[model samples]
Target: MQKSIAVVFDSAGTLLHMYRVAKDMSSGDLLTGVESTDLVARRKGRALIVLHTEPSVILAVDRNMRVIDFIDGHDIAIDISCASVPFSVEEAYDIIKDSDIRVDDILQVVGVVRKHCPEIFYVAAGIIVDRNDHSVPYVLSTGGRLFHDSKETVDRLKGLGVSVFIASGDSRRNLKQLAECMGISMERVYDIATTREKARIILELKDTYDKVLMVGDGMNDILALRAADVGIVTLQQGDHRPEKLEMSADVVIRDIREVLGIVESL
Candidate 1:
């Protein structure tokens, strides 16, 4: 039998909202460990550096920095943990040496991160990085929770014979857990950790499905929405920056259940 329209959903905002963890989400300036005074000096010379560090687990910043790729410090390594990669002291310095990023650029990226992660906190200006190569930052990131009845919505979509896929900036482990909880096939999930990757995945899905619908609620999902045949923005009351999403998506939905109706009509 011919397949119904395929739907791709962004994991963080579209499938689940931000569920608080131990503390509210916050970010702060990157600090230097001993002998690493040069790092802070470099920032002072060029730009103010801000970072979102979740101790022992992750360090994140906006993607525009391009610092994630060049750094190869002993304690620091870059990996696809989020849209932005985390770093340790040496790795962060590696990026600075290779890229020579300016202060204005760092400010711009920090602003974008602040806008998106409102729970973001700016750590103390002079937080010490210390000589400990494995020193973890004090800040911690929050978690995500599925929208009310989200699993039911996926089940309903499958009931209607629609092919459902997940494209998200979240870690593979998180997405895998979500897939298992919702009974979604692991093969159908894509760890699209960047905006460009999300759009690329949508295009790839388009090749297999006659029609593709992309649904999301964050700025990162904008490009993918435009790439799909139909883009739906799921709006929740009191949510941040709904207007931006409304403008980006082809259709604005107030409820996750609305997606089922939208698909049926298509």
Candidate 2:
């Protein structure tokens, strides 16, 4: 019998379900819920969904491993189609690293969020400072990360003899940290990878594997998802509809745990 091989995961959604689940999926509803709360993050409350689209388009860790603000969000957006920065990382990073958004604002929002579901504070805040004037407001960047079963999940797949690979837009240093934390080998990971590269890599493994599966949540993972024998998608929103991804996916889920069930049968 031939062994089955799977080219797995697009990251930030499939394996890592970003935007922790929330009862209220809108900005106004999230803020209002927080305003009614007094406590900080609680495991027994509703989750807070992401307010923005992309996370990496915001602050990037420099070659020095320092978190540096990338583009001017005020000029562009944290959306998938990102653009150039008009300001310097030095000037923009200071404002966000030293935020005045009031603990009350965050506490209220996070509190209300926790009241409905379990939430994780993966990132504090991302902002930018003015270039010409230091005191002026620059922009608010985006964020990402998931509250997940980090180590166990990967081990489960590895035990099944899957040659799992991670190709992400994140830096090599960051991916290495995550892979180590997950007990996966850094030698098996690829960082700063583009969408086409993801697809190409999967096809390259086609000669070895009887079957391959690709799972993702972002638009960037579309091509790679389609290239696989099976594809899965994890995001569902009105504006951020998982349509393109759904078309690419053989399986679709609002949750990530559901994937194990679908993949094991294959």
Candidate 3:
């Protein structure tokens, strides 16, 4: 088999669509970033900042110069359950927005906490940088597909004498689980991966492969799509929506069936 590849897509709109844990399919957005993946860390850190706090003194500014208490997580009774991380109270508050913690629930929780405990705040030094630090594990990120026919796709690609790999910005655990469910190898799947790194991987593979195709949805898919020889966008209509993703894509399709054809065309 001649070494040739084409067709890459964004996850959410391109591959599979996933619904949030307890929310409707339309609950979340497609633009999640690095901080979004470290949500557990951000949430635990935020909970810790609220420990032992007086709500009245939490410094916060509303529209029109109103220093209303930060009505989000500034109010959770921060006892000691979440006191391990060395992040600050302010950091916690800001971090909440970046985390994948349910927006409606945690925001309401944080707002309620702020109403009661505003004074007790601690600032943990050391911002959590998104760089590939030694502490960061190997990550895989997807655009938005929860379940996929990746096994057939990868197997076909491999049979065609191609090395196939998966990358996603979704939950690493979730991707691992899905790969298992699909009977695809874990070595091929990547979860909770950053957008930049996804593109970097495509570029790295470009060195070895005669051609590489990266696919995705949303803005994060932009870089990888451009990096590949052919960019593909996938979209779904039942509840999960990705209307605008195909605008920047070279070709848009509904399933993985078209992948090999695109490569053949090239």
Every candidate's lDDT: 0.56, 0.47, 0.44
Q: Using alpha carbons, what is the TM-score of model 3? A: 0.51
lDDT of 1: 0.56
Winning model by TM-score = 1
Clashes of 1: 11
Give the residue spans of candidate 1 off by over 4 A: 1-3, 20-140
| Residue-level lDDT for 219 in candidate 2 | 61
Residue 29 Cα positional deviation in candidate 2, in Å, after optimal superposition = 18
Candidate 1's TM-score reads: 0.60
Error of 3 at 182 (Å): 3.5
Between candidates 2 and 3, the one scoring higher on TM-score is 2
Q: Candidate 3 on 1-266: residue-level lDDT in tens?
A: 56655333334434455322111113332222222223323333222221232222332322232111333434433211122233344444444334333323323323433333344121110112122121211111212333356446656766676556667654444456556655557776665445566777778778877888876645556567777777776553233324444565678766766776776675
- Cα deviation in Å at residue 210, candidate 3? 0.7
Ordering by lDDT: 1, 2, 3
What tens digits encode model 2's per-residue C-alpha lDDT throughout 1-266? 64687756655544543332222212323322121011111222211111232233322323222222222332332211111222333434454344333223333333443444344323222222333333312122122344365356667778877777787644454466567766777777876555667788778778778887777766657778888888777663212544555787777766555656766776
User: Which candidate has the top score in lDDT?
Assistant: 1
| Model 2 regions more than 4 Å off | 19-142, 236-239
* Model 3 collision count: 43
